[model samples]
Target chain A: MWSRSNTISMIFVALATTLVCLYARGWGYTIVQHIGISTDFTDITISAAIILSGGLAMLCGADLPVVLIIGTLGVFVSLTLAQDALVRYLSLAAVLFSIGVYGMVVSRNAVRVLMSIELMLNAVNINLVAFARYVDPNLIRGQLFAIFILTVAAAEAAVGLAIVLAVYRNMSTVDMERFNLLKW
Target chain B: MGENLTALTAWAQNHSETTAFYILAFLAIPFAYGVLLDRRIIRSGFLLIGVFGAISGVFLLLQAQFLAMAQIMIYAVGITLVVVIALMLTNPRLEHDVNPAIPVAKTSGIVVSILLFVTIYLSLRSEIWPLSPSPVKADNVLQIGTGLLTYYSLPFEFASVLLLVALIGAIMLARAEHRPPSQMEERLDAQEDLSSERNDNVVQV
Candidate 1:
């Protein structure tokens, strides 16, 4: 249920968010300073900009679907651009991990849940590699850890899918809600 | 004002890598969302591949060439394809997309996910990370190989064993149920055997 005008409005909102984040350079840093965390304010700035855009879109009567799309895109773009380069990478990883969490929680299908879990693992891998790149580039301990995670993730996927198959054969349904056999 | 504009333009031009990062992030996050939120599970399976492929590109950007190749090989090409096949085998009739989650559970799920994310984000922003300034050497693959076979050899061996066990377990679990024939089919077999015996007698006669 998306109209052309709504889509246009959403793009406008996203563009507006980009402009704000790009120009409000030290706003993120200031937020971090107040928080007393050595980390940057990239995450908050992006979240605020996207939330602001969404509110603006609603005020302008942008449809719900358009607003959602714009908000997501705005978050995506700002996530990559926030903070310094190394910190920006970490922020992106955080955003991804959050998305994975949302998926794992909300998905009804068991296999979809597994996919979400993989997404979460990949997000962790991103963080590891980012740290490896920016912090310990010489040793690459982070990359090595990432390799181990990859191995573990592969093993987990195999075991998980096998269990899913067994459950499907027994119950004829892969819905997460239907898996209450273990519940007291 | 003119000087500020010029400085901003120059800074933007110098940060071309950031532009690439933005492009890859755009490619990855939406597809990852599709994997979870798409009503059609089959489409989600395909979208998972897209997400992995983009993540592999991100790995390359981070200078983890070996990890990037492995990501593409193991995740993009291997695991996702397996997932898609499993989805097809499990749900051949497309009868799945209809069951919406109860609103209460759905809302709780969203709340929990948001809480977890907020916690992680806050911690990441607040933590003081130990950072090194040295660049990664050119012979990353060699160093990794040496480390894997030497200092990390125990874990490497364990990982292989784990893979072997998982492969065997998956094969055993996914094998078709060993069901016997029904009574009607058994009776039909008997009748066919009797008819064949009588035909043989006639031929002998």
Candidate 2:
């Protein structure tokens, strides 16, 4: 049951990593050379580790112990390998995103599910900011958009939780299975 | 050492491509994991904080100091706090058989979700994102503030009104039920007791 095949997801993640690395190597050589840092080996290693952990989590099912160990190690290693400031930020963001996903899968509560969604949103925000920083330094619109996204997220959380609370009050238990009020 | 540090900062500032590469790679881990993993609340909360920190770093790297600060203050801090608080309020106890009932509409939901994802992906691929040649110099905070106050003022006010309504609704819903007969009977008994005590005091006076 734990080792059900997930070849497609793994391949997709690997392919994405490869494309990202190739792009970085080809277009970012000048910047890397200028910084005088040798990151090719380190970058590949970090990427591979992330892919492995993510793949394992998906295939073997989301066991908290395995996820925590793999995610923590992946985050630490990636952060250590990251030479650029932006890379550091991205590494941190990615770790959070993974943690959030872990929460979403393992959590049984509706509130926890909402929290996980917030985590995922935050991860996206980090990426947007990082990209904005690199691609357009002067234009801070991406950051502005991220703030807007946050406001929307907040409103969503408030409404969602309110609904959950209402449901809980009606039914003594906060169990999702018991929330079959609308079910025919 | 000072010179080297300056050089490093300058190099970071200039290298957009490298910045993009790292940001994407870093973001990919979470994005992939989020989609694949089963939900876990505390882990998700922690992840949100991490993502927020990363985004703030991105803003700083781009030299959008205001944006970075806002991202940290609002999205990272505000949303995370709200979510965590909501989780506490809901108070989910762990149990083995707490899974959501498998809906008969599962097929429809899956089909719709897949279609939506595909549509979004296709649209994203087809569209050419316009890369601005020159970055805008406007302070984003000031612009956002002004926009909210001026042109977007009506919508802002409406949102505030909506929040007030919701708050009122929550209060009404959460309030304890009062049985009319019980309340009236208790009130009558208290009144009779009070009247008898008052008569006794009057006689003593």
Candidate 3:
């Protein structure tokens, strides 16, 4: 039999997060005012909608990929509604980062895990470039940092895949569960 | 005909960028979804290319033309291809969905990941990100090039060195083998040999 208790608990958590996201935008107004950047309240309701949808998806036991796409698009759409381009870009990055986190946690394959890590790095790059565009347009340090991060990410992917390949050769399986040689 | 054309152009002139953003998002998100959730692992590799391409388009929208170009060259083409190749090299044929996580583990993963997202979203909501009043430099490419060669020259060189080392390491890992083929490799090799032999026999007959 399906565990209804866990499902109810998940719904509560999702609802809680939705409420938090809606209220948190207001909490940040004073902080943003200090930095001379004005924040918009237009996207809070949208974010709440998204959180609710995500919770519904979980309750319905929808496919993982569908849930991820919804999460990403929800953030993207909400952020795109913002007046400040920096906030928009940063929100997109945050969403991508969370998706990466999800992928890393759920993936069984080593290559998929590497792909998730790459996604996270790319999200960080998005944040960097957004900052460069908005924060220090004169110097453009953020773009430079983004480039370095990209290079480092490439190197990491290559090395990570190599390690995975090496492991595969030895063990004949890329499943993370089977990679507990060090456990014993 | 001309009236319709003019109206279309007017619409494009007004909303083309937003339209492009929507198009690219439509293309990117689903493919990115495929990259993570597709039961077919190999297909996910291909979907990744679409995701990267769409992301580069977003970079273009952000006016990071140089970064966008680099994204296309580096991530869209280079890294994605490498990932696909790695996927092919490592995975066994007929490998469908492999159930690695138990049901409880999966549910927990979902909870944890959603929580993580909520935490990040709340923090971002609470913080103030600075924004420059002025537009980006006109000659962003030139400025970036100069910055790379001058101020960030050392790190730039280090990245190249790191890439070279990684290339060498990957080659060694993938190619070098003293022992006989493992079971999966043997199965793969056998399939290869059988196909080749079949081709040869057909040619002779």
Candidate 4:
């Protein structure tokens, strides 16, 4: 359904976002002296915004479910934008983790499964780092756990890819349906 | 000019974290969805890198600078291997792209993910976090290094050993020769013949 121009533009948009994030000099100074920014929009508000905005996007004929996957994430009004809450970070992590779970279950490709597992692990890492920053920043106990998870995830990825390659060598196919050796 | 500058700085200070988070999360979700559902398997591998990079941005937003760098470094290496493996296993030149054909997995996967998201989000909503009054120190890298070497040294050592073991194990597994399906079938046939001979002997006895 994506035209060439549309696809190229999407890539550009993603690149622009990545650049802005990587190069932004100001990393959200608290500036509690200047202004104390807070938001009245809580969890309920965000949830409602996602559903309503996503439904409207679907109505506007952007793709069906993939539009819903992210259409609302970037829609926060500037007034409601800067809610410095632990739950905000935690919620993003949850969304990523859920998508990873879906990938792991639905993908017939073994490599996709491994990628999904990595995604899930990164989700956990986000939670750890969020806790480190918000709850125990001085001690950084959560960052410690995040490091371990990263290590294990790397090891697991390496091993999982090797196993997939090995299986592919023998079977000459990477389809999950074909790898039915243990299936009774 | 000074007034204008202060206004811009104030606005930036107020909105930067949430703006960064939203942008990265926006990038991440679609790429993740692509990783799961893209027809081209190799493309999915590439999308995985996008997802990783965005999450690393999230890490940076949280002020875990060291972990953010580590996220990029580690996932860079890991995702490279994954892409290589995808190339080795799949032929994008073939007529049929790799798509999930299982109707059951499709429906059930969506249902399960929705369930998981709801459970986790609802659970998180009910809980109150103990917020720290103190701001996070700027010297996070130093703290992490000291903690790893001092308090968490044992686990740190254990992680290194685990990495080494995984390295050797992956090499061994990938390097091992694969028995062809024909040879495997031959071996199975030979086993069947032996069992049949044993059955005859039992019948005679």
Candidate 5:
């Protein structure tokens, strides 16, 4: 399957799941705050419905592509359902990390591999922000740390890509198993 | 007893249950998945994310926001990125084949990992975590900045220099040189006689 289509479908599913979870959790205000959308509902009743639908979709022996899309969507929905900022942040981080791991383990493209790592980094940044909110409501140290991490990540990416380029020049291919020059 | 109960009730009222539930779920689900899954990458990634997420939550609950942020940024983001990038540089292909001859080694690795997990779990369970006497002050950022500039200035400068040196080394190693290798041609020439002899043997056979 073309990854482009898969990415789009995954994003759609995530949006739908978030909507369902918000409806179910009776926390319409939370979603409203996140997307700047206003809605009136003291207690929404859509969480159970979405969970059932999602579970059924998973159990239908769907294609791997479909399952991956739904799984990613489910993660997003679950995270957004969280009511507290800290929980929401952690959930977002978890989803990002899991997606990154999936991409790292499944995709063969170098760019995809790098993207997965970036996703994981973003998850950590979210966690940092949440934690900072918890510890000191006034301090922005968490944001600073996140910036530092981003800087380091950028440096690492540069060095890593350079190495990959060098390896490609020498071998004409990036197949890992072929790099056996140092095995002894 | 009445006073203690009132205090407990006040604490519970101030805190959000949704946060606690999410944290617990995140921590438990990954561990369960790790135990049930056969794939190492899946298991490891899930476990790491769960553990880190839980720690971050605890940090938030404990009011050590800066430390928690550092934990997530440094340990979760930095380390995971390094590992994933390393994986990418080495193998872009997601090959699932395992060497049949490495069963014993694989088993040993699994055993060791399980043992380490158990040890850590036990220690965590036994530890007595104390709540902060007072909520963290709002000026933690300023304090951290002051500490970094005053007490940690030398180490910070050294770390920067070390990073620069590493950057230079990485660039040097990765830079492509157009010049022909001096020894490679000589080595190929030396192997020519062996190739010719093998060709002769094949013809004679």
Candidate 6:
């Protein structure tokens, strides 16, 4: 009984690891080097290890979706780390943004979806602050925008959670699949 | 204790910004993954708190001290509230151990996110940013406060107004009755048949 599930999970771990490594190597060497900012092989391997951690977790096991999400973000992070200072910050934001997108798409729970959205907003804030650091250090207008984004994100979360609670009251479950009252 | 504290400060001073940046980003990636990968959704919510904390440290490293503090104060407390709401919404009776996996959505989510990440990364690398030669001053909070009062005064007031609106709107939405007033009236009118339909929405007196 354990062997069957274990075989499938092992296959998933292998696939995720292979996919993440191929992308890191394929992009890590050529395009990243051509750009003239890519780091050494050591860093690339470190990023690959980050992706493999997810693969390991899955082999150790919750399911496939979680592993894929981790792999995708890992690829984004490791590949982006090839660049230097400002670009690294920008790429990290991009990695977080990608994870947020994956979560938004895969999550079946309504609250989880909103949480993914919050992740996406925070990623944007990172970009804004990074730009403030690089582009306009003296005036710091990017920080101002980030602060505004923070305010709006808080407001959005408050309103969104209230809506979720309202939905929960109408229908006892918070599962997105079960929300069929308005479904045509 | 004083000697150890001074030694620690000297050690930190020896490392450059790049070193600090790598350290914090490395510290953060796993927790960010944990936010979505955990089996329990509530657990993921708590994981998000870790992500926020690490990112706030990155903000501090970047010289945006005020943003870092604001991030900690706002997101830490705000996410905890989100987790609490998730707890309230979860039905104890419906908790389960496992599910038959859905593969199609899983594949699509991965595909779309990778495509989007590639697009974002390409755009970021392709463009050349116009970085200023002037270094950021040490007193970031002072600069930010001055800028807020002088340059961004209008938007600052608007954000406060927005927060006020959200506070009132959220309470209104949560307290809102789903069924029409007439259905509610009919339900109240037929007190004899009250036991048939359960009224969870309280009719305010």
Interface RMSD of each: 1.7, 6.4, 1.9, 1.5, 8.7, 2.1
Report how far residue A134 has shifted in candidate 5, in Å.
1.7
- Candidate 6 stretches with Cα past 4 Å from truth are A1-78, B1-16, B92-95, B98-103, B176-205
Candidate 2 — which residues are off by over 4 angstroms? A1-108, A116-149, B1-17, B20-28, B31-40, B59-67, B95-122, B173-205
- Report the Cα RMSD per candidate: 9.5, 12.9, 8.6, 11.1, 14.3, 7.9
| Best by the DockQ measure | 4
| Greater-DockQ candidate between 3 and 5 | 3
Q: What is the DockQ of candidate 3?
A: 0.43
Arranged by TM-score with the best first, the candidates are: 1, 3, 6, 4, 2, 5
In terms of TM-score, which candidate is strongest? 1
What is residue A125's positional error in candidate 5, in angstroms? 2.3
> lDDT at B11 for candidate 2?
72
TM-score of each prediction: 0.80, 0.54, 0.75, 0.73, 0.46, 0.74
DockQ of each: 0.51, 0.20, 0.43, 0.54, 0.07, 0.50
Q: For residues B1-205, write the lDDT of model 1, one tens digit per residue.
A: 7997898778868977786787888788778776766778888889999999999989888889999999999999889978888888677333343643444565566557556756865676567777777778889888889889998999989989988998898888888666567865776688679658756866676
First chain TM-score for all predictions: 0.73, 0.59, 0.71, 0.64, 0.63, 0.66
Candidate 5 segments whose C-alpha is farther than 4 A from its true place = A1-67, A79-82, A138-144, A176-184, B1-147, B178-205
Write model 6 residue lDDT over B131-193, tens digit each, in one string.
Answer: 777767888788888978888899999999999999999999888476898998885677536
Model 6 TM? 0.74
Q: Which clashing pairs does model 5 show?
A: A24-A47
Q: Each candidate's lDDT (Cα)?
A: 0.76, 0.55, 0.74, 0.71, 0.51, 0.73
Candidate 4: tens digits of C-alpha lDDT, residues A1-184: 6665455445433533333332232222332123443323233333444455445544454444454354324332211234446887887888889888888887777777888888899999999999998899899999999999988988898888888878876675677777986779
lDDT tens string, model 3, A1-184? 5476456545544654554454434544554456555456545554656667776766676545545565666556655644355665676677667667777888888888888888888888888887887789898888899999988888888889889888987777788877976785
Model 3: which residue pairs collide? Answer: A134-B132
Candidate with more favorable, higher DockQ: 4 or 6: 4
